[model samples]
Target chain A: MLLTATLSLLLMQQAPSENVDWDAEFGVEEVERDPATGEIPVEPYEQNNENAGAKPFTGDDMAETFGGRDGIRQIAERFVEINFADPRIQGIFAGHDEVRLRRTIFEQFCYILNAGCDYTGRDMKSSHEGLGSRKADLNAIVENLQQAMREQDVPFAAQNRFLSKLAPMSRDVINR
Target chain B: MTPVFNHFATCLMVAPLALLPMSLCAQEVLSDTQSIDQAGTFPEYNAKLLLTNAVSAVDGASGGGISNWATIAGRQETRGVGVQAHVTAVLLPDFFYQSHGVALGIADRIELSYARQNFDTQDVGAALGIGQGYMLNQDVFGAKVRLFGDVVYGNTMVPQVAVGAQYKRSLDGAVASAVGAAHDEGVDVTLSATKLLLSHSVLVNTTARLTKANQNGLLGFGSVSDDSYAIQFEGAVAYQFSRRFVLGTEFRTKPDNLGLGEGDWFDVFAAYAPSDNLTVTAAYADLGSIATFTGQRGAFLQAQVAF
Candidate 1:
């Protein structure tokens, strides 16, 4: 036992310390570089999309699956109810407009589902730019979304299919 | 003593067989939520935490590519029981090495593992006058318990630590004795520390092993030339590129007492988890030298299933 304790201490000492600044270690610039100036090159979104290939969901498919626009609306309402009640995510809605928020969420889901809904809500990046959202918050929303879909009798496969399409949006909503 | 050791190894091999009936019994008592995934209402069966835990290593302990780590296998749950099985194949230039094992993780604390390794000497056996296609078999039983700290949310400076031991016995005792091995059975104690720097999406683990094994007990334990326990180090660093993919490299130091010129091992690997229950790892390993043969480099493939 004493030997085990000594070896544990030695191995722990071998690990890298927390004080080392990784950003500095990698020589990353403290200031953000603009891509237009080519200081920090950013890959074109089109190229990224090319690698990702075509998305599976389409307006016609989503429209048929959700019974056109009405089913999407029902899903939206139930999602809001779950979000308001879920402690993990309820705090994010503390000061939001209930009716408008529901409408926005409904439109967002419809658009992601490619249900041919003319979503009038703000763009995803702008809407979530300053909420200090983390991956934890996004995960909470996903959990609530799953619960809402369950209440609405959505098949597990269908839920996953929808989520796969929407999962990429995390880059825009989290840690922005 | 040898007969008793063989009996113990046999018992370890049969333990998994006994677990089958118990697993079926437990299934009968599964909660409604546990059966939700089976009913096709839930897509995920295990939903504790993401990428916070690692799959079982070839030796059946939770770790990186080839080295044992401090973290437990399966998803991160404070009070959950998890079990995993793995099949690993390492293709060397002059030998084929394979290991199959099962592990049990209890309440995110204790880990018990058993692995059986087979080393096929291929052409080397003929050259060494040990008969054609001679094989070496060994059984390793490991037990580890987390001692302190949490890798994911530990104090800024401390890493998660665990203390473990592996009792290994070679089945080919006669052949082991011919190779000048001092003993056919030996025990190894290990201390492992692991840390995940989520901020940088990097994972690191360090382990120190106190052992007398030669070539991981395939060549047997200790030797006529050296009989004391030797300290070995294994280290790994991985980058979590995405939720499902991890790219890593490992370095493990080995003793050079067996006169066969065994050297340290290194590998670069990529592990992919399609789901919480299934993982596949592919690696290019440079095992340095084994049995006097130089540059034993080859590919490694491992597949694991956990619940």
Candidate 2:
């Protein structure tokens, strides 16, 4: 009787291991941020400026109007900030790579505004895949971006000018 | 249902003899709301940007105060639906004009609208032997479909284009026949192109309308002498002062089919959106002469709500 009791206690102690996540145990890997770029590495594709989705302005006036590259960077950061905080669309963006978004968004803005930057990110279509975004979600993002631009003192007309460049991307960003 | 809505529906059901081929499927217009997600709450319906859906025109179509555009009413996007309702009044020196109606927008592709207009002849009614304070009522039912392009997106060089038709029925057949009208009902076909030049902060719309309407079908269709349709033009230019404020001017030509000397219409208007759901428009309108009363001008006021 004493031996049987001891064996049962030992079997119960080993039962907890049965619930272990076998997928992880089977060597599934979690993506890690690159030490150099501070962003999770992605499967690579050929990069092109056309991926920016818009042509840059011809003159430097538009760039200057946005307060140069630094201003563009700040605007991008604020835009992402508002997007992440906005409850209406946050669920769609919650799992996004914020570090990568800040840089790529800045690059897209800078390139489009003629502030001189190359976009190294994926195209709008691929980047927004599996996000389950709706038109209302897209509108929320636009509202947030507008708020960010307004905070950066972008003139309303200028803001709309910038918006016109981004508005066309909505078809790609929003789920059909 | 409100009496006004019941009346509007009644008018729609009773007027099946219109000149145009159309369907009666409209019951609402663009809704007023800034962002459906305001206050961090989930929205029941999609909400467009402030004033993006456009205000309710006097005719109940999606437009400014007096001119129709290529915009679809409702705060919904390409996959959602929306509705709006409006009440309007114009106090002319010699007459009083009132209109109310509803419109429905579907999937950003089609818009259906209905409006009832009442033109009180006031003292002019007595002079014309139609009894004092006689009112001329007209019911306008409209449908519009977007042919192609986007008003706020796509290639900036390509404006949004649409085709629409308004089937009008005059309720007072006796008064209309007495005025030498050939028919009590007519149709207006319109093609419109509209664009919002965000870079310039301007909105432009030009519409070509084919009609035989006398004072927008209040006095009825064409006259005994001529009952053919005439092509008229409607042009509007607006400046967006802010997200909620717009100032603009419009010009619309009218056909004097009855020889009532119903001249063209012009207005300088301002539209203000107080919230996502309410927009108020005030304008100085010059309707020219109506019937024989010359110098028909006045203040045009409209209030609209959409959801």
Candidate 3:
């Protein structure tokens, strides 16, 4: 009788259940890009134009200077690219979603420059949380952005006008 | 130190890079005690926007060409230390003036500075019977603490404020006493406020000083006729032309306690920063007169480095 009991326990251990989900049992969760935006999903948060962090320029002069929506898109793309490649600040951008960042930054700049776009990103404080940005890092980013804008032949004065709108946002962007 | 100025000439021919700290009203710490810029993934570095720290003044502190501002003398932000060195030459019709010094900044909060000033009387020395080529020398030691506010950040209405002290000691005590000076050494107390208006691309600074020095203490402190401290004013207004160029004017009032007709100092200066670490300033200074010699006006050139 003891031998029979031992044989049954061995059979139970060896049996494989075809209906079982091994991944669910192992606690592995998979994330997929949204088919509509081609960006990964983030936590749901309320979005508003205030999330852009500054009031948009009312006139079209700035928009035209930045080459309208097309020019701003190019600038945002180049800015992110430079940051990811820079040795000093690349670590902060590393592991973040490039596609999502490019889209959101473009939206923010477009909305601010009055190039006519809506910002759907989180507020600066929430977005920068845990990223650990410093004053030096902010300056580096500024220089890289300047380089990108220069490549687009943006006037230095116009760039400063745009920067004035964004300069105060440092209080929110830098993690104290 | 003038040799360093030579490097400035070739640098834009060569190379390329603070704010009045965005200090809060409640900030009292000598440094940023908290560990910021460390937990982040960003690499360590020192960088401030161009011309934001201002230039080293005649006294060797971070300021305009002739006026002291509420700025620390370094390129550091909130995390680390920085330093600056400067050499200034002022050529007047009757006198030759030069100053050189170095300053140390700690955590963008406190500043310590030392400068040596030499005033060459030239022909006027012979006229005054002090021997031709007579040089009046003094060492100026300065310490400043940022009381509150920021030059670059925060509300535009708020400005950076600082309190400082300068101790001036003349090396020629006997000559100074023989010339009717009450003392050969003195202290200057100063309170300064500065702000950068971004929208206007302008910077403004004002300082109130309590001092008893004659010709900034090179001619000695006070005179036998009037040995009392006087309230003086220093003011500067700068217009930013670009990230690298600044045009400004400064006026500094001095105590004429020596009663030799010392004139208030004035200068119209143009400063260019070829890179973050290098700034070259050239100005036309009108010193009015020194030691009864009239029309002391000419060129003032200074080269400064910060890191």
Candidate 4:
């Protein structure tokens, strides 16, 4: 029986299992497919990886530094749009109110930017208590937000300022 | 006595490499490398996660100030490259150790690092006839690559594993020879595993190193009595108190190959990161008998920057 158990353990160790390559699986290629010559594909998350770009914004007040309320609105809109479509994280948003989500996201961003906006959403830890969110899912959302800020032309430093405030929320949002 | 010199020597050798990461961070210009996605976001510091990227140790691999860790260097993943530099100083009662190092994280898969150590023998130098406050120096170049699993978020039982090597050379080879060492240069290889239980906010690392150096190459590589490489074990456990603060303890088992009476080493440490671009670490270490001195206890501090 001991020998049989040992053999079983060895076989279990060698068994094939799911191996998700988070990088390749969640890369930019899938969302930005090319047509015609198919050569001018959009730059993925890697090539444009500058958290603090040239002429980057520098200051403690991120909202005003990033074009004030208008910039936050644009970034929030784009972030919501992308999150709704991102396959990696879209499933978690099912049955939720899109309008409420958008408003919540905007208010949260404003609060982080210290724009004097009040966030009425539930506490992050409690809201995400049973979402079954994983690191991969959270990473996908952060990437989406990054893409949104990039599209809005927010300075890399500005983007980092906003993200830095948001980054800590991971503790509350993941697998609580 | 030899251990004091060894520690001091390794610290100086690591200094220059530590300067590179900060310079890289300061010199970065977005216009030169600006390739934004359709949504206009450029990828930066995309590999691993925040605070997950530890500072380069005295040995030039990512981890605490002294122990080597299993995480890759830098902040980049396969989509980008990351670089970090660090400087560490340990002030002991009998001697001092200073090290500078830089590490590169490639695609979150591999890590390459180099460090130099400088050891100041202080008054102990007079007894050894090397001169008071005599300094010894050595250089270490190292590389590590991830093998399997993920430390932060893997569903499987397999821990994140990495294997690396450090090539060490003593600049003061004459002093090493005088101390009855077999050689002044040697290579130390290590296999390390790390796992993080995110739910518990805990991280654990275990490393096995094959080395021939006495006092981490401060007394040179190998001894006249036993010149063969021996295996050593290192372990660390940390609890994440917040997004930016971690408290931990580390223990390293050493080989008693030389007459220096080298014993195990232990430390209690705290690491804090105010931002992704910077980190600071402080620790209290108990480095058992080195050479003739017993109870080499001291404070350790390290500052690191990465991009």
Candidate 5:
């Protein structure tokens, strides 16, 4: 009697719950019953591996997603246009000679493009000297540049690379 | 007894000299104290905003024109106590000068600064009638209080406003008083505001200052009452091109107090932060002249390190 009770407790622990209807849900076919005992065992389901695979991204795929450099240039041009409209900037470049001013703009773009060409324009001091430019004017220009970059969807990493090159000019640009 | 008395009197006379080294040592101790006091006054932001020293311009805000030259004033983030020392030198088109001094942050609310400016105008020749040339020297003592403002997190309603005053005095008493000028002493006051628009990635800083000083401690004499209370406006914008770098520009308009000239100032600049504690900045700047001078465009380089 003691042994039988111990076996019954062990079997109860290992048995499947009555709430689980495995045969009905999984559509398992009927199995032949043993002559001495009316019991059958069910097999585990097999997994399909044919469709579970990883693939590499190709160059053509990247082009299709980012739309390449041409798309980036268009975005840059729009940025310049919007930034030029700022009133503070309007005051700074207001009377500047068009030819020289255009050159300045072009040079900035060339540098951004990483074309490997010398800016060749006047150094920041010579360009702004005697102009009486102020901190407000500088802020406007920076805002416009940022706006332009944003419109182009330039990656944040690339934008920062450009900014790192530009930040040192502040000392020459203010309180002189 | 008579000789002994004489010896005692002599020792008494030498007592001051005997304590001279102790006094010097005391001064060194005072310097250290001043440094600690200055550091204690800055905002809690100093730990993360360590590069405020070298920039002099403090984010986008101007502390107080020539009177307030440090980037950030007071030591604490909001208010408590602190101290700072700054040295700046600029080589202009026609002149070169150096300015250096110390500032104390009190209650993390008010700040006091003293700076001496030494100017080398080179050769003025017969224009001033003094000699081949003469150098101009002056001292400026200034004070500022954070009336009602803050620049932390994303709060912008307060606008970080400050009011300040500066007193300038010249060393050349005769040259200064001879021109009907008031011994080269005057007071200047300003109201400043700074704000950051994080969504736009821009920082805008503005200042409106009133002054009666002449040549800003340059030129021969100080300001005449007739030209007192000149109004000046300055603004700057900085765009974070990346977490570690920013590009900015500035525009400032000044009063024509020198009777010598009139105009505005502007610049384009860029700043880089190699780490949270160090920042390097450069700019192309244009400063209208003291009087009839023009074409004073130039460049500047600055580095800031904070602890």
Candidate 6:
């Protein structure tokens, strides 16, 4: 009878339960009391907070992630370096030195980041103010952006989101 | 003394006789009709001339010849002002009727028009009437400006284009408002590029219209949803056999917004000028209608007189 009772108890323990045992032998630490407000404990940023259940921010992790400012900067740099050879851009920015090109790339990057910086480089209206660009020029810009995104392996979803925001501006930018 | 007097008179008479042939020769040379014909052919006029007198077909086809006749006449003499009143009465074999009123070329730049359409099918059958046959009417007032001229012929600087806008309002407000329309009034702006391809004997005109009006100023105003924009293309060619007559054809496309009409229309037209001021035009038009309504073809006639 004792052996059978013990076997029945072991079978019951194998069933699933809604309750979680934090004090089990799996190495999870248990807190006896909550930390006092305004008197926080000093812990490393990466350490998982037992009280707030938050993880730390790391620059290396940010560099690995393909979003936010760091990722945008990297993508912008690659795009400027690779697609600057496009004929459309060459025609529009003819006689522009490397410094001007770099400045334009930086302005684009800043605008994409929404970093609250003044993009003194002319808006679409002023940049194409009197240029009288045709539909071909607008299409060429879209193609160049697409190729740059593909070459840099920017995720498809991110690229689509950017294009949706950029597409409507074509009416203002292309006049011919 | 009497003999000397006779000699002096003879010398004077001989001198007068000698000059007569030279004067006659000069007059004959100067009075030739060739110079008069050349002057008559090329007269100087300051007003804009109409190189052609043709309507833009529904499919964006230009009628034969250079329809710029209207523009040319408007620009020729500053006092040469004219108004055209046109009423198109369309009778469908199925008993539907449409009518339009046009007051065009007022001030040589502004045009005002009104159109009304009725969809009646009682003569056909009861099955054609979904609920009640309605008479739809629209009022359109248009204003156009001749911003610049000689766009095609001038140095390749600016395109020969004209910009205009039409403001339309529907008469059946209750019915038009019930369809989730944007407003009772809609405005459509058009930029038309007209190029004279002289080598091809053709005028290729393309108009990009941003419009929210539903029925081309028919069915009253604001009957169409606001989410529609159309690009209409028209090409017209005229082979002139003589100075007074021309035969031509046109093809054009209109937007199908209300799902009550056919896709596009085409026409073959011939025009004759009986005099410098009077022009008569006749055309066979195929204007398709809504549904399986075939045989929507008809004939068109127009008379234009300019002073």
The per-model DockQ list reads 0.02, 0.24, 0.16, 0.02, 0.02, 0.00
Query: Which one is best on TM-score?
Result: 2
* Per-candidate clashes, comma-separated: 0, 14, 4, 34, 67, 26
lDDT of 1 by residue, B1-307 (tens): 3333343344445647776333232222233324444445423335333545586666678887679899876553444577778899999989999999988878778888999999999999999999778999999999999998766542435788999999999998888789888999999899999986654567899999998888888888998889999999999999876557889999998987678898998999999988867889999999998988999999999998877
lDDT of 2 by residue, B1-307 (tens): 2443443444445646553211221221001122322433754544577787788777778987877898888877766789989999999998999999999989888999999999999999999999899999999999999899878776788888999999999999888889999899998998989998887889999999999888888888899999898999999999988788999999998888887778999999999999888889999999999988999889999998887
Q: What would the per-residue lDDT of candidate 1 be over residues A43-159, giving only the tens digit for each residue?
A: 333322222212436547655666556787888888887777766555567655566667767776776666765555555666566777654466667767767777777654566
Task: Estimate the TM-score for candidate 4.
Answer: 0.60
**True-structure Cα RMSD, model 6:** 36.6
What docking class should model 5 receive? Answer: incorrect
> Model 4 - which docking category?
incorrect
What is the C-alpha local distance difference test score of each model?
Answer: 0.73, 0.83, 0.83, 0.73, 0.52, 0.46
Tens-digit per-residue lDDT, B1-307, candidate 5: 3333343344445547686433333333335556667656633433223223224432112242222322344333322344555555555686565566666666545667777777666554235555554677787787777765443222334455677777777776555555445546666676777654443556667777676555564543334545447687777777766656777888877665545574677777777868654556667767667445566666655554433
In model 1 chain B, where is the ten-residue run with the lowest total lDDT?
A: B22-31
What is model 2's DockQ versus the real complex?
0.24
> How does model 6 score by TM-score?
0.42
Model 3, B1-307: lDDT tens digits are 2322343233323332012221221121111222232334445455666777788888778898888899998888767688889999999988899999999877768989999999898988898899999999999999999998878766567888999999999998987898788999999999999987876778899999999988888878888989988999999998888779989999999977777888999999999999889999999999887777888889999999988
Please give, for residues A1-176, the per-residue lDDT of candidate 6 as tens digits: 53353334344443336587746847765433224422222233331112111122333332233355555556666666544576544555554344444554554544543532233344555446566665445545655665666666755444544544454454557664
Candidate 3 residue runs with Cα over 4 Å from true position: A1-30, B1-45
TM-score ranking from best to worst? 2, 3, 4, 1, 5, 6
Give the winner by TM-score: 2 or 3.
Answer: 2
Model 6: residues with Cα > 4 Å off, grouped in runs? A1-176, B1-80, B87-92, B95-135, B151-159, B174-184, B220-230, B291-295
User: lDDT per residue, candidate 4, B61-142, as tens digits?
Assistant: 9986667888988776555578999998998989998989899988778888999999999998998899999988999999
Q: Which of the two candidates, 3 or 6, achieves a greater TM-score against the reference?
A: 3
